[model samples]
Target: MRPDLCLENAGRRYGLRGPWVLRGVDLTVAPGRLVRVEGANGTGKSTLLRLLAGIDAPSEGRITGRPRTAYVPERFPPALPFTAVGYLTHLGTVHGLSRTAAARAAGEWLERLGAAAYADTPMARLSKGSSQKVAVAQALLAEPELLVLDEAWTGLDTDARAELERAVAERTAAGGSVVFVDHDPRRLAGLPDTTYAVRDGSLVPCDVAGPLPSGPHVTVEAQGPPDGRLPDDVRRTAASAEETGPGRYRLTVPAPHSDLLLRALLTSRPPWHVVRVAPRPDAPGSSR
Candidate 1:
């Protein structure tokens, strides 16, 4: 079957023959699966997402996928409380959803995100986490066949984080696809079917250690006291270990790396206990 999302030798640049942010990326995100793209800051992670969302075209290769796709950016767009549901309705309409369907879809997801109480609130009064949830809800309102999220959890709290996982799980289980671009894969444990490390326009496998299919070993721990921990949104971050062990709960994430996700989740209060983080067998670029 044709993949839901395909990047055929995709390439992009910032200037005129000066530097290409992305070189040649070959990848496929199929239905009922997610292919995460990881990389460092300014590495075109967001750029690649843009190309895939149909917002922009790759300078070189072709990005093929379902006709409609959704993108959740790293820097979330602000939505006041009062404008929240209305905004969702607006986006749904743009996607060709009817007023009633848009209202229903908006209400359902808003409730799922725990923002239903503020359905009529203005965007200006919503908290950062709340607004981020709105942004997430907006991107996902259409329930497009393909969803591309770039750090969609950027400003969400722990509860909101869980909500995201639940949404993705439910979405994909119904034969949908997700293309998530986050720094660390550990944040969304029990998720992600395939991961990719984006380095200079190249898409390669991420060598997650332990039982992680492939990718770097990352660890996420509370920097300070575990009991008095902040939320993941406030101090989000994670880490990885070099060793691999049996009977350990190992998970795999794509390219951006665990450290980045850890830092972002510092406030989210990631697991500080070593027992939570299993060991990995390989670093980046490893086959086994």
Candidate 2:
């Protein structure tokens, strides 16, 4: 199979020589496959996307790919000005598109992303969701072989989100590739094949073969020895991971979203994993 992108032992540190945002990273994305990077704020998610897009050079390691890439960041740059249409038209012109052709491309992307009405508005003047839609449009305008979206869905509503998802799916179907970051995993549920967690200046695969790092502060202790493993849903949404007692585990989750976590626990379809949340904290020997 032909590999569309390859990074070997990649490391990046902004400035001449300082702290590194990404270190010892290795990844490969072939044609027709999607990989996601997931993490909390300030976890180098954007830095990683930049590295993938070749916007910046990696301090160490190597990247091999054709010049088929598009990058869409969370917020459009102030330099682009508030004129979203003009921004795209100018970008297209830089790529050697004539004014008329540039206007045509910009118009099509604006309509496709549902930001047609906001076409002439300056990007700085657009709302968060609208501005993000502009960024999406910018990335997809040229239809690069590889597209990188950084926080691409942060500002979109439900319908807008669905439209963007469909667009990406269709692109992949046509032999294009994409990589993007999403703050909310729920928004990304149907988007990526592999989700990566970024933390402590590192990027690692997440939501595969292990539990998520966040939990509702629930710990499990078997009366006897524990067996098998925890479910993927628990792992993906787990807040933190800590071993409490012997053969017992505790998962901390945001208190407000505790019920959603519990509901997921109860509704395991195959029924392989079962958690019992004790109704009262004071209750003896209760678990979920």
Candidate 3:
């Protein structure tokens, strides 16, 4: 049986006479897998993602298994007239949700990504980071079967970026496929099920079993009132927290998850103040 998405010797180029940007690519995207694409600038990464998201057609060869997909491009046009929430609602409907359902999902995603307060703000008025949040929310409003992220984390706050990481994890956990390209080499650390490098206009398999760190862990210290609380999502990671002083507390989280924890502390309704984020005492190179 064919995988959820397959490209057999697929290739693409611009107008008839344009030089080929991507060629002779064979890829199979299975269900519930995390695929990462890596390459330098102007090397066809965006072209490959666009083709996978069905935004562009391949000039040659065949692609099968068109799953319902959502794509977040590297750049988001923020001049649209719709309010952030309204825009997301519109996209949700386009993705097949009912009007009421779409609106609710929009609110939910906006809240999750820390953009709820700007829900009513016009897209043109939102700051770059806020606009990026809206762009991400729109793609996630309908729970697409395939999620393609092209540097989608750019311009997002630390917390929002971590929220996106969680969303990616959720999508794959629910039996969906995810493909992404991020500038950070440690973006997801050692999690992708497969990694492919775009080389010479073709796709090449990368070593998924590379010796990357398991999960760089960090310790954070923050200060807040006695009654302050952390975000609910922080519990997902094996994080530990405790009050160390009259108004100071400490949290130990996996490095990748630290952003979420810190965001929770700093963005809380009362807003805890972070003191420091350092590698755990026992972590590699920490003692030296």
Candidate 4:
């Protein structure tokens, strides 16, 4: 089983006397959870993610539980001598896959991200969007237990962006953990199990789920285990959950969060049975 990645009161800085980039950070990336880190430019969002991915060591405190990890940085270097597929294949082998298996997985991810046409193109010759696709593919080719992404969607087109989201959902549903940073508030919207913000060189919990929009909401009816217990993530994501009968629940959540809530219920150990799903016409705006 994969262990939770933990950062306990961690701090980092450049030089011995340099100012701290991040400090007093305590975070735990648990299995099957999605975490979001938010901050303006130069607020150490990337630094924090680097710590989580083991790319950098903390200047103080400690980080423990290093799971099999992969990371996609904000900028991907495109000047490598190898072709896109070759680069990904090389990375796959480094992650412990055999040469044949690595090449096969490389091809699959490239095709899924709609970049198969550029498979043999030199890394430096590919377009920015195509290069970004290669970068995303390499991180996912290994099926890592911990995935860290820093603005991994910046250069992708609409279809590629949607494909990455689906990949993230699949990872978490398969009992992997993911942490990401994106500029768009709606990137994952209501899907994150927990959201944190970097403020004044510290990590702080923040409510990313702002006020409800004037759009329609979703109502899900599900039945939990025989003990009538729901997963913590399912309860946290729902706006309101009421028990109408034993082991049965009616959950109301914003439309954007419905998929995440359902994933939590259905992916639980014993799994929750969904009875029905319908849109709540409480809001007077367009459907989501």
Q: Each model's TM-score, in the order given?
A: 0.69, 0.66, 0.76, 0.81
- Specify the poorest-scoring 10-residue window by lDDT in model 4: 279-288
Minimal lDDT window, size 10, model 3: 230-239
Tens-place lDDT per residue, model 4, 233-281, is: 6765666677888889888776655788888888887899999999995
Window of ten residues with lowest summed lDDT in model 2: 279-288
| Residue range 1-288, candidate 3, lDDT tens digits | 225799999999999999999999999999778899999999999999999999999999989999989999999999997999889999988999999999999999999999999999999999999999998998998888899999999999989998898888667655688999999998875667789999989999997664333465788888877765544433333245566887676666656556656766776667778889888634332110
Candidate 4: segments with Cα more than 4 A from true spot? 209-288
Candidate 2 accuracy as TM-score: 0.66
CA lDDT of each candidate?
0.65, 0.67, 0.83, 0.87
Compared with the true structure, what per-residue lDDT tens digits does model 2 show for residues 1-288?
A: 345698889888888778888998888877655678888888788888988888888899999874577888766664465498999888777766788988899999888778899998877778878888877877777767787888787778766776676556545544567787877765434335577888888878875433332322343321213543554454433344344544345555443334444554555443333334432222122122
| Clash count of each predicted structure | 52, 23, 0, 0
lDDT of 4: 0.87
At residue 258, give the lDDT of candidate 1.
42
Q: Judged by lDDT, which candidate is best?
A: 4
lDDT of 1 by residue, 120-220 (tens): 87887788888888889987888777788889887787677767865665456446777787665565543456767777667788754444334435433
RMSD of model 4 against the true structure: 4.1
Q: Which stretches of candidate 1 lie over 4 Å from their true place?
A: 1-3, 79-82, 212-288
Whichever of 1 and 3 has more TM-score, that candidate is: 3
